[model samples]
Target: MITGPLCRAARALTELSREKLAALSGVDEHVIELFERRIAAPDANVVAMLKSTLEDMGAVFIPEDRRGAGVRLKFTASETKRIATLESEGGLIRGDDVP
Candidate 1:
């Protein structure tokens, strides 16, 4: 199950607005907003719908465990290449070389 913070983070990472996510998930806009704000709890079906929609858009939900939960983008081939190039150009640290 995706937590409120994780859901919000996924939306931010995917550049998806509340309205956009509502439309894509077929859930109400207000429902999405309230859920993301942690003001309301959505039922299981609604949560599943949101998670499915986000997964389709490349957002991978990390399950809660001892390490805690989160979300991250499932990088595509182009994204992988772009990140590698950026790292090579000093936009990011190479390998585990960050100080």
Candidate 2:
């Protein structure tokens, strides 16, 4: 289960507004606001819906552990491909000269 803080953080990372999230998740904007503000708790199903929608938009939810739960953005397919291509480019490794 995700916490209210996680939800808010995920939304920020995904650059999604409450209205936009509500529309995408089919949840009420007021419910999302209240939930994020820690004012009210919505149904479990509603929370799941929000989580799924955010994930689809690139928000990756980190499970709770010793360091605590968090949220991050997943790299898009194009980004992954570009990174792989760059990694496959064999070149001499050199240290940067800084003084």
Measured against the true structure, the TM-scores of the candidates, in listed sequence, are 0.76, 0.86
What ranges in model 2 sit over 4 Å off? Answer: 90-99
Candidate 1 per-residue C-alpha lDDT over 1-99 given as tens digits, one digit per residue, 9 for 90 to 100: 787788889999899998899989999999888888899999999999999999888899887789988899999989999988977885644588558
Off by over 4 Å in 1: 80-99
Give the C-alpha miss distance for residue 37 in model 1, angstroms.
Answer: 1.5
**What's the TM for model 2?**
0.86
Clashes of 2: 0
Supply the global lDDT for candidate 2. 0.92
Task: State the weakest 10-residue window (summed lDDT) of model 2.
Answer: 90-99
lDDT score for residue 46 of model 1: 96
